[model samples]
Target: MAYNAGMTEIQPSRQVDLAIIGGGAAGVLTAINALRAAAPGQRIALFEPASAVAQGIAYATPWPEHLLNVPAGKMSGFPEQPGDFLDHLLARREAPEATLAEQYVPRLDYADYLQQRLAEAAAASAGTLQVVHDAVVSLQPQSGGHRFQQAEGANWQATQVVLACGNSMRPLPLPAGNALPPGKVVDAWDYDGVRMLAGDQDLAIIGTGLSMADCVVSLLAAGHRGRIHVLSRHALLPLPHAHGGTADFDPQPLLQLPLRARMRQLREHVRIAQAQGLPWQAVMDRIRPLGQALWRSLEEADQRRFLRHVVRYWDVHRHRIAESVHDQLMAVERSGQLQRHRARLDAVLVQDANLQVHGRGTPPFNVGALINATGVETRALGLRNPLLQQLLAEGHARPGPHGLGLDADPDSGQLHDAHGAPQPGLWLVGSLRIGTLWESLAIPELRVQAQQAARAAIA
Candidate 1:
């Protein structure tokens, strides 16, 4: 009934209860959740421009070498359909042992699972939930409120446009400008670019986060044996996962104390965990919900402080890889094929056949191929992306506070349009929401967000 729903916005026009942008995980998840929250015939459409319509960047990997970082058990998307992905993997013969074990399966399995869900959801709705593969370059509000135009020339008189741009590429701030030699800098997602590396060629990767780990794994899988020097402002690689030797205890009484005090007590608890042969990862995961609640209790400054200081440490400690990948990293380290430098960049210069980046610190920052593994740029709200640029230029939308991402209220998911008003017909989700929702990356967190967004649209 969304397509025929009454207009609650400016002027009279058309409607598609909700128009979600960026067809990746966020978009599809949003569509599915909206379907859950929709009336019998509520109209919804998702736009994803990748090669596959429903399969976003995660599953878009053509190479079988790339693997999902999470275990199959944890990777199952829906909270209720716990073994859905595992079942699909078994049915398709992708992973016979994956269902029972906590093994990290191929990224393709998860991608296929998402595609399967899209197909099932579509079949169930027929008309209510439709998906469009076109990319939305920009959105401009019409004379009436909440009405807008799609960059592809589609007249979208949408009641709400939810921006689910999953992960924005981190800009390469080369000191001498953003130009690199022919084969120097590469975005991690360029499947073809990553694969083209000769087995003998060495590459320099930047950043020391999970994505950096993924890139390292990708290089190893491709048989790249050359030395890799991963440099970053803070060269702290993600912590390893728990050994899972059975240690689960809760802070029964200490949890009732004040937030900061509770945080300290939790750290103390983890120390005890470490002494008891428990993995730090287990401690971190056990404390996640508590951390989130504590985070909410903190003032804005404290939140900003957490972002500046504690978040990275927490990320590495909390979200981790399987033992297999960790072993590979350790092997690379022991073999001296990999080097980590905690150096701050002073300048970057690229010349013929050679790429050089200058930094201050011991060992220094020197490399041939520099991979901008710094991850996505969260604060670029008014940058050069087609849709984002136009929205800011036309005063149709504004960047979120803290300049982290597109601003939206958590309760309503209503986007802050350019006029500094919460636009009912607009929503923002995914990693694009890191500024507001710090724990927005994992599949479980994303599923909840998508469900919330869908429910809000109908309400």
Candidate 2:
């Protein structure tokens, strides 16, 4: 067995007990639990292109102002020890004012926390955990388990493999043959690029979700003070989080109703709760725990209807941002520097030195740059990711409900083949299970899924 101190260049063993395909939070958590549960002499390898583990696109931001959407108390990597993250923060003095569990620390800090946890798990485990800084391009089932091919490494086999590839940002949805200047369009996730934009340069950000919020906050932190145009088909900013109070609201009753009716009933219930001096946040928090079950209760058609009609509203309310962050956004909006549009982007035309963004309902406008923050690329999963493409191209996996993600057994995180047979020794966690489990991407769900997948893999 061989190992390197940091991202390894040491040749991998011919076989490993488990192979995790990504090194983001989900993959790191899965690795931590797998190492803890592994028998002596067992080998686990994690493949990731990033030089460091756990800093997925979400947590790779360098700015201190980019805080975790969830509070520190609830962002623990291990479900059994829910206070682990808070404890780490206190020990490191990362959150000096974090006497309460509600403190929202920097996202980069969370990355550090995961890296440290992974190190601790590796040191304490009886098994060998290899951090392979390589991107796995293809995975195929072999005699006993699966064979993995990486872009720049020796092929290896693993008896159990977990795909925690995480989320892919949707590219700019531009029409074919649209004339646009090169380098004018930037990815919303590229905080380094976004923060470096010339101050006072008018900018247009496409998407009105959490990613957009992140872009806005980053710009403000960087002292960007120019007309910022935020455009989306339905221009809606996420609501702010509210503290205090609990609600005993049950969503089981609404499960019997159709999707549309259920939404209406939920609205009525929220209004009633508000009238009684109970915060809507309390009711929302209650629904969040049962979100997957409620989603599963709906028929396929009803689920589609919910996605089309109600998911946006649910997202804005359910995935609320920190109040402090929300206030900063609102302050910019109130000052007339930040503006939002309810329109669909059609084309980007280069005019003189600026980019003219054209869209329906909203007149054409010129901005120095365009930022794409449209969030996840759910529709064309295979097209965007090669590993996913190979999995779908072959019969190793099939699309999940609505073709949003790969199909997997929600309970065990086991992948299902095209023929609907469970592929033994193969599993997936995090965003890949989005279609099957509506609430599968967050830390709470990912950690649980990681624990389950690890236990199964090691067993």
Candidate 3:
């Protein structure tokens, strides 16, 4: 297989057997599976605007301080080969601190592992796989398949298309016409910008989620000694993972209760597990696998209520960080370097040389830089992806539950059109399935979806 480094203007008009869009972890995994399962002469195209594949927003961070939230053992790219990621780390002698299965490795090393896996998959496959460096702007349904129009280079058709673009960052929540002060407010997604701030300049991070935790770690790693003000509605930070343990709790019974009752029952289970000398994380781990099933069992109204009131608490307990990171955050808090506020940011005032972050019931605090760590935009209505915009505009696709993502068949990831019809040869994977599957963004779910979508496309 030959990988094209750049897009070319002139090319023969040939439709590919399969086209996997996005080039991130999801797309790369799908391409790998497709390449292995495709016929001898089948051709697959993996489109990524980036120079390389597998370095999506999540894994593109260059800082070693940014570690994978999950353990190395559970971060494998292939489901059948459960130890592939851990094996890769050992083979390259890149396992830092510890060589055990539960070691938390740097996300940069994970990106390298993904790239290597992609290369090996392409090399060993009987089918031809070519990576096209281009952004797909528009995808229109055609007679036999779909036609993809790229921002650069020649447009082409594909027998099947897999939309694997990851989630987009939500815009800063500010009042209409309230523009952010230029250069003073940096998004957390811009790793370089966040890490390059002046060491002594006080900063304010907008959220208290994992992204905020990451920003704090990055700044501390960069030798920053400024006051970091973290603000959120709940003022909650992600909990730390347990050292190592398992809880034999069954989550099926909770599904039979109402949303609030389920939550109550879940808390009871956690209490029981704690009484039995098990960490709360162990109970959460047991429930993690059944998250989607439990989510789908709730009525839409109950689901909305859960989102509005219970999501923050659930997130802090469910998506935990490594014990080391959690400890660092605690040290900073105790040293008066990190301050947490339970409030919402209502406005930002440009005062002299600093930004004044204001929220109801809280006094305005001045900071040299403000970081937007509000997290990904789950709602699909105002998405900035051109292809997604076009799809919704033309009624080619509809939003998923609670308008979080594009609607698709939960089993095969086959996308459904506006009329509730499943579009042939069209599939979706990754965070885009959040509305349909609550546990869609993690590697375990992504690898499974990628494999299933690939097999279905090939079949």
Candidate 4:
């Protein structure tokens, strides 16, 4: 609970087994896993910039309305505790009839759950975890390990560093032509930005992706109904969830098959499931265990092909919106109160109070007030985080293929260097290693990675 103020320099410990740079979900899981894997008395540290450790973009829900996409049964922080979230909800009297199938809850509660977990780990740690709440600006490889240079300007040394810096947003290209004096274009993650809106405000949302959908919901929840328009290159919406069903996951035969053949077989199995009435999410869940194998099986060219042709579609289908939230969206769509357009934004200009944004698609666009909700900006690495840019410049870590994310080995999240060798002690977690493992953004997949990455960190 004690986080450093802004930043302060502290003497590096002479010896420590693990040092994680990110304190988001992945970092939290990594800490627990390290506690699980490391010998007692082996030192561990997690660096986080937020006021508290483990507060990532997703759980930093400012408004009470923001909720988790996954149901309680599936939302548990620990994979082994499949009903952990449900139990928590039940104990708190927040459980609905369909705890696993339909219950949706605020994200702050999960944040609190993580905080409690951290507290438990801290108490049991016996000085095992040395969590520092400071922004890590850069990393430099030292003898057998690395040195972390703080963003607020400090230093620490550790044998290992996990880059769980989650959710690096893509920056919007500066609008050409007249520019808004200020406060016209907003990012979807702008939790505090809601205060800037007034009743009866006309809002133009750029990129109708998941974040855009969430933003629209927030706007509607705020009673803003002047005329909301969504502009994007594609009007494609997220694929709906098919609820849940009991499905047996047997991975033995998959483990026996050759990589490519295994991927082909699993793809066919998923297709058959969808044909038989199993929802896409259910099929994906069944496929979770094989995700890593399937990713590694694909040749580099095939991986690129999937990214170009299928990544977005896969993401929308995989990370579903809750039924309640989706129904709310349907209401907006049916009433014509919300408009979805497929087109390229030509330009945006701000002249005093009036913000003008142009577009090119069926009907030309000129909407007022725009918000960028393009979800994860896989390509905008440098613009996404100052920490990443500085690290890339200092040669601590190199960018992955096509700037997908930090490069790493299949099992270990150890980021690679300029010559494509894994940096000695640096590791990444969750979606940050997406470039290495394509089908990663989910908790089940991430939980496994957290354990493996921690074990690999001992290297």
Q: Cα deviation in Å at residue 149, candidate 1?
A: 3.0
**Deviating ranges (above 4 Å) for candidate 3:** 1-14, 94-99
lDDT of 2 by residue, 372-450 (tens): 9999877635448888898998989999889878899988889999997889999999888888888888899999999
Give the candidate order by descending TM-score: 2, 3, 1, 4
Residue 26 in model 2: lDDT: 95
Backbone collision count in every prediction? 9, 0, 0, 2
How well does model 3 score by local distance difference test?
0.86
lDDT per prediction? 0.67, 0.86, 0.86, 0.70
**Superposition error at 199 for model 1 (Å):** 2.9
Return whichever of 1 and 3 wins on lDDT. 3
Give each model a TM-score: 0.87, 0.96, 0.95, 0.86
**Comparing candidate 2 with candidate 3, which one achieves the higher lDDT?**
3
Displacement of the residue 168 alpha carbon in candidate 1, Å: 0.6
Enumerate residue pairs that collide in model 2: none
lDDT of 4: 0.70
Per-residue lDDT of candidate 1, residues 246-289 (tens digit): 34777454445654675687788778888987766666667665
Clashing pairs in 3: none
Model 4 per-residue lDDT tens digits across residues 170-266: 7665454545545677788886674356357667777777787778778877887677788777677765565656345565576566545665776
TM for candidate 4 is: 0.86
- Model 3 lDDT tens row, 115-233: 88777777788877777788898898898889988887578899999999896887777898878768988889799999998499899999898899889999999999889999988
